[model samples]
Target: MEAIYIDKHYNLVVECKQGSRKACYELYRLYSKAMLNVAFRIVGNIGEAEDVLQEAFLDAFNKLKDFRQETTFGLWLKQIVVNRSINLLRKRRLELIELEGDHLENIPEEESEDEDDVQYQVAVVKEGIKELPDGYRVVLSLYLLEGYDHEEISQILNISENTSRTQFLRAKRKLMEILKRKGPAS
Candidate 1:
């Protein structure tokens, strides 16, 4: 059973790479829901997220040659989805406020003091993160949620690495502010 599942995935990728429409459909069926979740997380709007998914899949199919085997095909496709979602955000011309380097370094690292209630602390932090501005939200999602580094974020957003760092720091501050506004953290 395990081998058959693996073979199906591998064959779908190889056949899709070879321009087989049936393989592409199979791959899409397998990955689309997960890809849509990623897209919706980054884009935050269902309609826009769907658009990103479509564009991402098209780009992935077209550039199959460029995909090296450093990562699994699903991971590669997820990266494309993330990159395309970031591109869509940039196209909306959101103004990213550039923070100073010193400010970036000084972001407060407030680890939860109460160790007994870890789940509550995590829930508070998650809510705070969701309340951040769109730019900060997207940057935080790409950096922390999607596991992309500053250089990769720079390339994805066409901004400098410094800018990526600054945005991440600022996003953290914004999250803190949101948490603060939500009353005392228990």
Candidate 2:
């Protein structure tokens, strides 16, 4: 078997768009893990994440002609993965809310807390996030872990930006409640 050395992913994309199955498969092999990670973070289930990954790759491959090389191929593919994951969440009929008032100003700034304490708190929060309902989990992961703004999240999830903001806030409050219930470890 000849090794397909893909130096630039866009090159592979160009080849794949030209109907090279090998190049397309190689593209999938190169990006599947990272894409899967993004999907898993959004969907919060191994099986569903895998489904999203497969769907994302298929969509990316089919839509390769639309790729303009402005961003790295991996980033473009990751966006597809994220969109697929969000779509899956929406298909589950999650109730997303748009904030009506000026609640964005109320979001607290990160305080200068101790590094170790922050790490511990983040770990605890992550555990709590895993316990969240699928709807909250997806929005929370996208906003917090993936660093998406409400506008980006709204576009991704097909909800209003205010809804994204509101879900994120509620998710945070729920996570904090869970952490409080867990209490300090001995």
Off by over 4 Å in 2: 1-8, 102-123
| Per-model TM-score versus the true fold | 0.76, 0.79
Query: What TM-score quantifies how close candidate 1 is to the native fold?
Result: 0.76
Model 1 whole-model lDDT (C-alpha atoms): 0.81
lDDT of 2 by residue, 1-186 (tens): 533343377678889999999999999999999888888888888899999999999999889998777777887888889888877877887666556774633445455458887788778777788899877888888887888898998887778887787788878777767877999643
Residue-level lDDT tens digits of model 1 in 94-131: 66765556455556565665666667878887777767
Q: Work out candidate 1's RMSD over C-alphas.
A: 5.2
- Best candidate according to TM-score: 2
Q: 116 in model 2: Cα distance from truth in Å?
A: 8.0
Question: Deviation in angstroms for 38 in model 2?
Answer: 1.3
